[model samples]
Target: MVEKPGDSPHLLVVDDDERIRALLQKFLARNDFLVTTARDADHARRILSGLDFDLIVLDVMLPGDDGITLCGELRAHQTTPILLLTARAGTEDRISGLEAGADDYLPKPFEPKELLLRINSILRRMPAAEPGAGVPKVLHMGPLRYDIARGEMWRGAELVRLTATESQLLQIFSDQPGAPVSRADLVARLGRSGGQAQERAVDVQITRLRRKLEDDPKQPRYLQTVRGAGYMLAPD
Candidate 1:
């Protein structure tokens, strides 16, 4: 297994076609994603059962089970964003995918760059922060707690250990609360330049923090996105 970089976004690609699967995996990886490829829905399910992913790129047509059914199944348990790929271009097909818990859908014969953009958009919409204003230095949300000034996280009485990057990232979100904190702001707050590498690093830290704070890390409740603005930490 590749040791995922602390900053790279982890993505799972599910497709039956070997050519498309490999092509997408390599392309996404080159674009700063930590890509994992599965040959079919069964393979994807096995991988999903064992590891966590930030998003899934699932082809609507699979070997045995259809992607829409699998999408519904995944949405029932996880909040990770799903982007569906299909040969069908009908509005009804697109709507069905969205209704089945897909965050977005793309018809086949589309550009990979567009897929990348859509992926980023869906991830951006995921909880980057919770809602609150002028939140206290010590923030509480559900079972998780954080000491903003000290850069600490806690789940109930137990102290949760965070990597240095993770601590810094959480602090940035906690400070803003309901306000969206941009990627540039996050880079500057963490004392790094606003380069692609640093931005990717922020992603890694956010993923780690979500795993720690969210009841279901796959579906965050506290940290959410504010559209074009940036990430927000919404505390209870």
Candidate 2:
């Protein structure tokens, strides 16, 4: 069925490449998604201030505050899912994007259909966690408290920022607190492909989450690694 206006998911495409921006805008629009284009980070920020989008497709190499930096900054306020487009397909580059809070990363020169698939996949899991995944209204982690329903974590009245991926992971772990969630399961839940690289990316996200949930991220307390299993969130 054809979707009506305002019923389609809205997307913000931020890229310095004119051709890519126009191509994505047209292609995503044809797919029934409402698309907004931004030439660079500054422009994206300006557009973002006045608009809300379900997802953001951002280019890594932008004019100012490159996409990674911008993604980190955006995570501080909103939990909009972000899929990064980068020319650098190296593992390190991909890990950097994940660390910065991107929901997914797609290398440049990728097929449009693949991008569409990724977009749809991410949107399908936009709710963060599956229904019946129960947890306490507020899960305590030492000085930190996570409001499960709100998907928010706070430290002494100050709200702790989590990337969209990190927030989703928290909700998944919260759903089954004390139980170990395998890296493969985490990758699947995160809507990423299964592979050593994908699992490594999941680990990077867990490490990032630990930084926020632990006073000593080096030796985590609440979010713990359970060898032979995976990771277990042992909340206090």
Among these predictions, the greatest TM-score belongs to 2
Write model 2 residue lDDT over 75-162, tens digit each, in one string.
7778789999999979999998888788899998999999999999878655443356666488999999988877788899798876
Cα lDDT of model 2 overall?
Answer: 0.88
**lDDT (Cα, tens digit) per residue for candidate 1, span 155-180:** 87887755444655676676567888
TM-score of 1: 0.56
For all candidates in order, the CA lDDT equals: 0.76, 0.88
Off by over 4 Å in 2: 1-4, 128-136, 156-159
lDDT, residue 12, model 2: 93
- Displacement of residue 152 (Cα, Å) in model 2 is 3.2
